[model samples]
Target: MSDTSPPKPVLFRSYYRDWIEVYKKNAVRNVTLRKYLLTLSWVERLAPDLRLSELTRLDYQKLLNDFASEHERQTTMDFHHNIKGAILDAVEEGLLEKDPTRKAIIKGREPKSRKTKYLNHFELHKLLESLELSSTPSWDWLILLIAKTGMRFSEAIALTPKDFDFSKQTLSINKTLDYKTRTGFLPTKNKASIRKIQLDWQVLMQFSELTKPIEEDELIFGSLGKIFNSTANHNLERRCKKAGISVISMHGLRHTHASILLFAGVSIASVARRLGHASMTTTQKTYLHVIQELESKDIDLVMRAMSSLN
Candidate 1:
C-alpha cells in the first residue's frame, strides 16, 4: 500500500515567544534576555516543524545530539546548555508538564588551561603598533580603552558618554552589544554586570583628552553619535591579520586584560569586580585552573629549593 503524506506545516509557537517576553520582562539583566533569545533562535528554527502537542523530551535530546555531531564539544555544550535554561524557564512558567532538558548535563566544560588564552605583552604591543596609524581616532582610542581598562568589546561598544564619570573616576556599565539582536544596547548578562568600575590615572587621562565636548547621549567610540560603526569588529580582525598576528577575536582582548592582571597578582575579587562578573563564583570558575597551575609551579620551586638545602 502506498502512503501519501503532505509536508508538515510550519508554525510559530506563541509559547516560545511568551517565554521570551516573560524572560525579557522579568530577567535581572538584559543579558539574560539576550541569551534566551539566542537559544530560542534554535528553537524557532526547529519548532516550526514540530507539533507542539507531540513534542517530547526525546525530541530535544535528539536536537542536542545532532548539534553535538555538527559542532565541537564545547560549542555543542553551550548550545544545549543555553537552551536547557529556556526549557527550564518554560517549566517554571507552567508551559511544560515535564522538563525536556531535565538532565542535559555537561561534564568536561571546565577551563582547561592556566595560560588564560589572551594576547601576551608582545602581541599587545603588536596590536597597538598596528592601530596607531588608523585613519580614524576612534580606531586607535578604542583599542587603548580596552588595553588600559580591560572592558569587554560589547561593554565598550555600548558605552555612552554618560557612563564616564570623570569627577568620580568611575565608569558605569549598563548594556552591551548583542550580535544576534542587531540592535542598540541591551541589558548586560546579569545584575553584577551593571557595575561601576574605577579607573587608573592613565585611563582617565587618555579619556579626558580623547573626547572633545562629549555629549551625554552619545556613545564613547561612536562617530556622529551612532551606537557603533557596525563594521568595527570585522575591520579590527582584518587589521590584526594584516599586522602579521594571528587573528584573535575581539573578546580575546578582554580575557587578555584579566590574564595580565591575574599574572600581576591582582586579587580574583578585584578582577571580578572590574570585569563585572555576576558573582565571584563565576570569576573563580573561569580562573580556578590558572590558580591551580600557579600553585603547582610554586610548590615545585619550593621542593627544588628544599632539596638543594638537603
Candidate 2:
C-alpha cells in the first residue's frame, strides 16, 4: 500500500533565518555578514509572514521598490541581489515552484553630487611639498606613503618595518588592520591584494632611514592606535588648503597616484596591479573619465601620424 505525506509549509522569514545561521554566518566575512543582516532586517519588516510558495513576481518587485524608495540605485541593486540569493536557494530546496525575482525592475532615488576627489599632477606635487616628514610617524608620513604607493588606508596602517624591502625597493602588502574587531592584523581584501608594490629610490631611501631604528615586527604607524578615516580625511583637507591645491580625502591620494600614472600612458593592467585591484575591469571602471580623455588625445595623434605619412 502507498502512503501519502503532507508537504511542509516554509515561511520566507523562517527559511531566511535558518539560511543565515546555517550558510551565510560562517561563509562570509564580518563586513559582508553585516550587510546580509541589514538586508534580512528589511525582509523581516516587509514580508515576515509571506510563505515561500505563495510569493509572486509582483511581490518580489514590490519588496525591491519599497526598499529602493530610500536607497540609491547601486545600494538597491545590492539589496535585490541579497534577497534574490535566499529566494533562489528556496527554489532549489523545492520550497517554491519557480523563481519569483526574475526580471525584477530595480528602482531608487537620485544620488547627491559630490566634489572631485582627485587632484591633477601639478596640484599633487604642491600637496606633497606641503607635507613635513619626520622620524616620528605622523599623518604627514602616512599621506606621503599613500600618495606614492596608492595603498588602502587599512593596508597602509598595518605596515611593519619588515614589510618594506629596501634592497629590492618594494613594499609588501600581505595583510590589513581589522578596525572593526580592533585586531592588529587581518587577511588582505583578496588574493590580488597580497602583492609587493615597487617603490621609487627616493621613497625607498626615506623609509629605509625612518624604519632603521624600529623593530622588524613593529608597526610603523601603530602609535596612532585605531585609525579613524574621517578624522584623517579632515586633516588631509587642511593640508591641501595650506598648499593652495584642491582638497581631497585620504583615499583620494590613491586616485591621484593612479591618475598620474594613467595620464603618463601606463597600461590599465599595470595600474590595476599597482592598486592591488582584483581585476583590470575595476581599474577601467574607476578611471573611465581619465581613459576617455586619453582616447581623445590618441585620436589627435592618429590624425597627425596619418597626415604626416601622406
Candidate 3:
C-alpha cells in the first residue's frame, strides 16, 4: 500500500510566504506590502533552509545576530518585529511545538550620528523668507504648505482645488497621492488623517486666487511628473543653503511645524489633531524634547507666581 502519512514541513522561508500571502498581501498599503516583501527576501537569504518544525530559540537568535551584524539596532528591531508575527502564528497553528523567538536577544551595529530633524522658529522664519513665491504654484508653494500645515508629502500632493474651502479658510486632507508608484489617489494614512486644517489668512488668500481659475477637482500643484521625495528634499536643501540655514529634508518641514506649535503652547491634543497623528502618544514621543523644555518654563512661571503672592 502506498504511504498516506502527512508530509514533513517546508523551510521557514516557504512558510513565511504562505503566511504573508494570507495575512498581509492585500491587507496593507503598497508601500507597507513592499516592506513585508523585503523582509521575506531577507528571510530567504538568512534562513533559506530553516525548517519550521526544527526552529528553536537558539536558531532564531543566530538568525537575528546575522541580520544585526550589518543593520542598526532600530532596523534589527523592525526586522524582528516583522518576522515575529509569522513565527507566532506558526506556533499557534502547531507548526512548531513552542515559540522559537522567545527571549531572543536583539543586536545590531552602532547608530550613526543623527541629523537635525527640525529647525528652531528663527531658522524657519529665515527659510520661509527665502522662498520666491509667485502668482503661479511651484514646489516652493508645496514646501510652504507642508511647513505651515504639517501635511505629509503624499497628502499635500493629493490636494485639489475643491479640497480648499475658501469661505472657511480650511484645507481638507482626505486622501494621498501614490507618488512612489504613481498609482493616483490612495486613502489617508489612517482615519485620523482625514481632517481639515484651518489656514492663516495670508496662505488662504494666496491659494484662493491660485485655485480660482482651475477646475474644482484639478490638482492644485499641477502635474508633478516623475517627482520623488528626494526631488523636494534637494530643492529645500538648496533653498536652505541659499538662506544660510541648516539643511533639512522635506519631512523636516513637518517636524518644524509641529515643534513651533508645541513651543508656542499649543495643547498636545491639538497638535496631534493638526498633524493627523492617530494618537497623542505619537505626538508626545516625537516632540518629547520640546515638551520637556516647555515643562521647565511652566515650572518657572509657577514659582514666579507663587513668589509674587508671598
Highest lDDT against the true fold, candidate: 3
lDDT of 1 by residue, 1-310 (tens): 8769885632324566665676565655555566667767766765556654354777777777665555566766777766665567666766567877767643333444443256767777788777663333476677677776777777887777778889999888888865445666677766778888888886786677666566778766666243343455566677677777756655667777877787777889999988888888887787786678778888999999999997
Provide the overall lDDT of each model, using Cα atoms, as 2-decimal numbers: 0.69, 0.89, 0.92
Model 3 TM-score is 0.95
Clashes of each: 0, 0, 0
TM-score of candidate 1 to 2 decimals: 0.71
After superposition, the stretches of candidate 2 with alpha carbons farther than 4 Å from their true spots are 1-9
Who is ahead in TM-score, 1 or 2?
Answer: 2
Evaluated at residue 287, the lDDT of candidate 2 is 98
TM-score winner between 1 and 3, please give it: 3
- Candidate 1, residue 243: the lDDT equals 76
The best-first sequence of candidates by lDDT reads 3, 2, 1
Q: List the residue pairs that clash in candidate 3.
A: none
